[model samples]
Target: MESGRWDELERRVAALEAAAGRPAGPGEKDPTAPATFWALEGLRPQAQGSGAVVYAGTFRSEAGEVDWQYAHHVDDLLGAPDAVAGVDEGADRGDLAQVAARLAALGHPARLAILAAVLRGHDRTADLAELLNLGTSGQVYHHVKALTTAGWLRPAARGQVAVPAERVIPLLVAMGVSS
Candidate 1:
C-alpha cells in the first residue's frame, strides 16, 4: 500500500478512536479496531450446538463504499433454544429453500457478468450485452430479471440497472469466495 493511503487510513482510525474516547498510537490496541475479533467473541458465547459463522468487511467500488457485518448461529436457523432472542416469527430466517433460490440466481454466467459490469459502471442492458459480449439485449434483460428477483440488482433510471448498495459487498464477497 502507498504511504499516502496508509496515512489516510491512520487518520480515519485516529478520528474513530477519538470518537470512542481512546487514543490511536503505535503499539497500543487499535481503538478503531478491536484487539480481538469482536464479532467472533460475541458469537462464541451464544453460538451453540451446530456452531455459528460470521462474515464482515469494508468494501470499496467505483459506485461507493460499504461497511457490513453479519452473523448467524446455526441454532438460529434451526430454531434451537440457543437462537437469538426476539427473532420475528415472520422473519425470513434464511430458510434453506429461500437461500438456495438466491444462490441459484447467481449460478448463471450471464447474470454474474451483468452484475460485474454494473458494478464497474456499465449499468445499461445494451451496454452490458456489448461490454460482456453475452448476447442480445433481450437476453440481458432475462438475466437482469433473475438478478432483480433475487435482490442482487435493481432497475435504475433511464432503463439502466444497479446492484442495491447493501448487496454490493455480498455479491463481491460471494464472487471472490467462489473464485
Candidate 2:
C-alpha cells in the first residue's frame, strides 16, 4: 500500500477501534482494510457521530461452525463507560435496561457453562446437566429458561435447543471480552 493509503487506512481503523472501546494491540493491522474489519467499516456510517461497538468471529466446535458479525451503536451499548467522547446521559433508558438485563442473565457461571455446553452440541437438558455436572435436570432447566428468555438460546428440535445464529458471535465476544 502507498504511504498515503496506509495512513488513511490506519486512521479509519483507529476510528473504528476507538468507537469499539478497544485498545490497539502491537502490530495491529488496519481494520478498515478489506476482509479485515468489514463489519466495522460498514457500520462506520451508521455509527457516525455517535460511534459504534462492533465484534465478529468464526467458531468451530464439535457441534459445528458459526460465522458471525455484529455491530451496535455506541449510544445503544455504552452509556456507563464514561470514557467515550460524546457519551452523554442522553442514551435511551429502555435500551440500557434491556442490555443490562441481558448481561445480568449471562452473569452466572452455571449459565455460561450452559451456553458453552449448548454451543458444543450438548443442547439437551440432560446432556447439559451431565456435561456440566449440575446434578439435576431442574437446575439445568432453571438456567435454560433464563438463557432462553434472554434470547441467548432458543427452542430447536424436540428436547434440544440452540444458540441463535445471530447471537453466536455476540455471545462469544461477550465471553471472550469479559474473560
Candidate 3:
C-alpha cells in the first residue's frame, strides 16, 4: 500500500482507539494483517493534553464506529507473554495436553457437530446418531469415545454429554470460535 493509504489507515485506527475508550494495541489491528495487529507495543504516551495515548491498529467491522470486534484479540496479544511467562509448566502441561488432544479429536466437522449437539444437551448415543446422521448407536459411541478419551467431552448426569467447563475456552479457541 502507498504511504498515504497507510497513513489514512493509521488515522482511522487512531479514531477507533479514541472511540474505544482506550489505546489500541496489536490485536486491535485487522485480523487480515496479523503481523501489525500483534506486534505493536511500547507505544509512546499521548501528548500531555491528549487525555490518553491511542495507537491505531485496524478496522474490523463496519456495523459501528471503530469496531470493537478485535478488542479481545488485542487483549490476548498483550497477555500472551505474561500468560506464557506465568505458566506452571507442570500444571499447565497436563491441561494443555488434554486441551490439545481434545481439540485434535474434535478437529473434524463430523466430530465437532456431534460434540456441539452433546454440549447442547443431546446425550444418548441414539440422539447423537440421529443428530449426526450416523447409521447406528455404535458409530456415535465410537466418536464419543474419541472425545471422552481426550477429555474434550463427557456424559452429563442426565445421560446427556457435555464439555467440561474447564475445557470450553480451549475448545472455542481451538475452533476459532473465540479468541
Candidate 4:
C-alpha cells in the first residue's frame, strides 16, 4: 500500500484508540488486533478440539483492504524431524537485530553484485573487481567486507572468498538469483 494511505490509516486508528480512552502502547495490539483476537478467541474451543481449524478475516482501510485466512492444525507434525527447520513463529530482539543488519548489508547494489560474482566462481578480489568493472580492488574489498560481516561470505583457501555452504542457497534466494 502507499505510504500516505498507510499513514492516514495509522492516524485513524490512533484517533479511535484515543477516543476509546485506551491509547495503544508501543508494540501493542495493532488496529485490527482487537477484532481479530476477539474473533479467534471465540473459536478457541473449537480450534483446540478437532481437525484443521480455519478462520477467515477481512480488514478494510482507506489505504487498502485485505482478506486473510488462517489455518491451525494441532500437532500436525509432532514427530516430523524437519517440522521446525525454517519456521520462525516468534523471533526475539537479537534475532531481529541480526536480520536487520544482514539485510542492510545486502541493501547496496554493489554488494549484491559482489555476492553474485562470488557465486559464479569469481571468488578473488581482483576477479570480482574486474567482473563488476569496479575501478579498484579496494571497492571490491569494501563490498566483500560488508558481505563477510553479515555472514554471507568467508575466506577460502589462498586469498579467495567463498559463500559459506549453508548460506549459498539462502543467499541466492535473497538475491532472487535463480539456480
Give the Cα RMSD of candidate 3: 14.0
List pairs with backbone clashes in candidate 1.
none
For model 3 the local lDDT of residue 23 reads: 43
Write model 4 residue lDDT over 1-179, tens digit each, in one string. 99999999999988887788684588876563457566656666666534444445443433244455556564441322233453443344345557779889989889888877776677877778778888798988888888899999998877798877656655655565432
TM-score of each: 0.66, 0.66, 0.44, 0.48
In terms of lDDT, which candidate is strongest?
A: 2
Error of 2 at 159 (Å): 1.1
State the displacement of the C-alpha of residue 20, model 3, in Å, after optimal TM-score superposition.
16
TM-score of 4: 0.48
If candidate 1 were superposed on the true structure by all CA atoms, what would the RMSD be?
12.4
Q: 1-179 in candidate 2: lDDT tens per residue? A: 89999999999988897888674478875465456666666787777547888787898877678888777776556555543344554455555767778899999999999998888878887788888898799999999999999999999988899999888989988898898
The residue ranges of model 4 lying beyond 4 angstroms of the native Cα positions read: 1-91, 177-179
Give the total clashing residue pairs for model 1.
0
lDDT of 2 at 10: 97
Model 3, C-alpha of 55: deviation from truth (Å): 22
Task: Give candidate 2's TM-score.
Answer: 0.66
